[model samples]
Target: MKYNKKAMTKLINQHRELHDELKKIKVEMGLEKNLAIKTLFHSMVADNGPYMKEYQELERMQ
Candidate 1:
């Protein structure tokens, strides 16, 4: 099977934007200070870290 690399790249970018927006909201609303909440937020951000690798590989391809 084949895929459109540009479309995939755009999708990844959109997801990253959404991620950042959510992170911003958490900060703006002061939700990151609680220990449990901060841990969760950090974990969520860590999960997104791997996507950066995938996005880089895709960008290198097309």
Candidate 2:
């Protein structure tokens, strides 16, 4: 498999930023007691997990 180093670096950085933002939202979600918003954030956090893992895998490819 071929990979572009610069592009991968950009992707990895973006992923880190996104993950950080998601974590902040998750923290905020913890303070939320509303059932609907909590449910949405739960799903959003779940969806982000796999993508973060994928980004980690890509970043590890050298």
Candidate 3:
């Protein structure tokens, strides 16, 4: 299947935005605090799973 460049670029941009948001959340929650960081990391992972999975699938297809 042919992939649409514009759509793919948008998806990639969204992924980057999510990554940056995660970083900000981590910093805001206190990265030096192990407990809070761990909790936030888990939550972020769970929240980003779908997007990450979709990105991986698309990567494989390409």
Best by lDDT: 3
lDDT of 3 by residue, 1-62 (tens): 23334434444456775556546766887664344334433443335654545544655666
What local lDDT score does residue 52 receive in model 1, on the 0 to 100 scale? 44
Cα lDDT of candidate 1 equals 0.47
Show model 2 residue runs off by greater than 4 Å. 1-14, 31-62
TM-scores, each model vs. reference = 0.27, 0.27, 0.32
Give lDDT: candidate 1, residue 38: 39
Clashes of 1: 0
Q: Note each model's CA RMSD in angstroms.
A: 10.4, 10.6, 9.4
lDDT of 1 by residue, 14-58 (tens): 576545655565677766524433333344333464344544556
Relative to the unseen true structure, what is the C-alpha lDDT of residue 21 in candidate 2, on a scale of 0 to 100? Answer: 51
Q: How far in Å is the alpha carbon of 6 misplaced in model 1?
A: 26
Please report how far candidate 1 places residue 50 from its true position, in Å.
25
Q: Please name the candidate that would achieve the greatest TM-score relative to the true structure.
A: 3
Point out the higher-scoring one by TM-score: 1 or 2.
Answer: 1
C-alpha lDDT (0 to 100) for residue 6 of candidate 1: 62
Flag regions of model 3 displaced more than 4 Å.
1-14, 32-41, 44-52, 55-62
Clashes of each: 0, 0, 0
